[model samples]
Target: MSELLKTLLVDQLNVEVYQNRKVLGQVAAKSVALKMKEILKDKDRVRMIFAAAPSQNEFLEALTKEEGIDWSKVTAFHMDEYIGLQASAPQRFSHYLKERLFDIVNPGEVYLIDCENTIGDECRRYANLLTQEPIDIVCFGIGENGHIAFNDPPVADFQDPAIIKSVELDLVCQQQQVNDGCFTDIESVPTHALTLTIPTLISASYLFCMVPGTTKRDAVQKTLCGPISTKCPATILRRHENCTLYTDIDSCGAVEER
Candidate 1:
């Protein structure tokens, strides 16, 4: 078990800081696996939303290796996808999740966000799929600018009426993609993406947020210490009754210093 470096309650957000990214991922994965088992015990299936980014690499890798949970009873959905990226674009969130997770665990239903059709049609279709049943869990990470999914500060809506929608990418968000090596440069990154809104994401019964690395230190600090507003979009996690924020030494550095 990874040693817990610190624990804090930022409003309702349960924050846990670990020694390092690897240990943060392992401990978060183990806890999420246990939640999967508990939910599957009384339910026919488990539905989960996932975020795809290099920040999620450790958690997804660790989760897939966990034993005992019946993956066949789990349905998966990714939180966001680039709207104009080529089908072959390596930066596509769907492809990222496929390579790191879906292909590894082979969930019973893997619903990826596709842009082959009109973005509107795709958004409606995905929203329908998501609302057909309740979401058991949401496993995700924050951006360098504190966006959750693709709900950047400029576009995030806490009470958004749409379950999903296309949003223009914030410049900081685009640069973070470059920083994470998902894009060669900011100019090469997609300008828009399809993302589930804050309401849809927080509707899940359980939320396990894994944020690691030095790049996210500022965002993590804002999420935990800043006002609860879309200005730091991810600060809304504080209002989610069952959400847990998992961080590593590097990501939580700002909090430690303060």
Candidate 2:
């Protein structure tokens, strides 16, 4: 195991800095696996939400390789999906998760956001499924603009009444899809997506946020130092009692240590 560069608490949140993305993923995956095992001891099923993106690749890879996780007892959900993408498109968040983790582990159930269907109906369907049980864990990544899921600053609502809804992507958020190589150009990215609202994501029993790379430096800084507002949606992490932010040295740049 690589040494953690720093460990600190920001209000109720726990933050850990690692040497690089690889080590960060390893440690984060270990923690997630352990938490799942702990939860399974007293619960019949563990419900988890995952983020699908290149930023989550490392952690998801490591997580699938963890030993002794009874994936058959786990039900999986994804945080968001591009509204108009074809189901078979490689850019589809469902496809991304299937290729990376779902197929590999074969969870007991996987409730994917059906972006090809009517957006409103899909939102209600998924929202109902999410509310069926309390979320045991949420493994997610912070966007370059500090958005969580597709909750871009313009659409983020800390007190949103709906659990899931369609949202227009901000320019910066669309550009990030290109930067992450998910799209060839900004024009190729979907303008809207169905996403779990801020309130929905923060409702999880535990949140493990994996953010890496220098491109995320500014967002990471704002997430840790800025006021808890919709401007940087990830700032809500500060309020979650069991949330942990795992970052590498590159992403933590310019943020003062406690």
Each candidate structure's TM-score, on Cα atoms with residue i matched to residue i, is 0.97, 0.98
Model 1, range 1-258, lDDT digits (tens) per residue? Answer: 667989988889999999999999999999999999999999999999999988888898999999998999999999999887789988788888999998988999999989887988998999999999999999999998899999999999999999999999989999998999878889999898899999999999999999999989999999999999999999999998999999998999848422
Pairs with backbone N, CA or C atoms under 3 Å apart (clashes), candidate 1 = none
Write the residue-wise lDDT of candidate 2 on 1-258 in tens digits: 789899878878799999999999999999999999999999999999999989888899999999999999999999999987877899999999999999999999999999878987888899999999999899999998899999999999999999999899999999999999989999999999999999999999999999999999999999999899999999999999999999999998757754
Candidate 2 local Cα displacement, residue 205, angstroms: 0.5
Best by lDDT: 2
Best candidate, TM-score: 2
Clashes of each: 0, 0
Candidate 2 lDDT at 171 equals 99
Task: Write down the worst ten-residue block by lDDT for model 1.
Answer: 249-258
Off by over 4 Å in 2: none
Write down the RMSD of all candidates, one decimal each. Answer: 1.3, 0.8
Task: State how far residue 251 of model 2 sits from its true place (Å).
Answer: 0.3
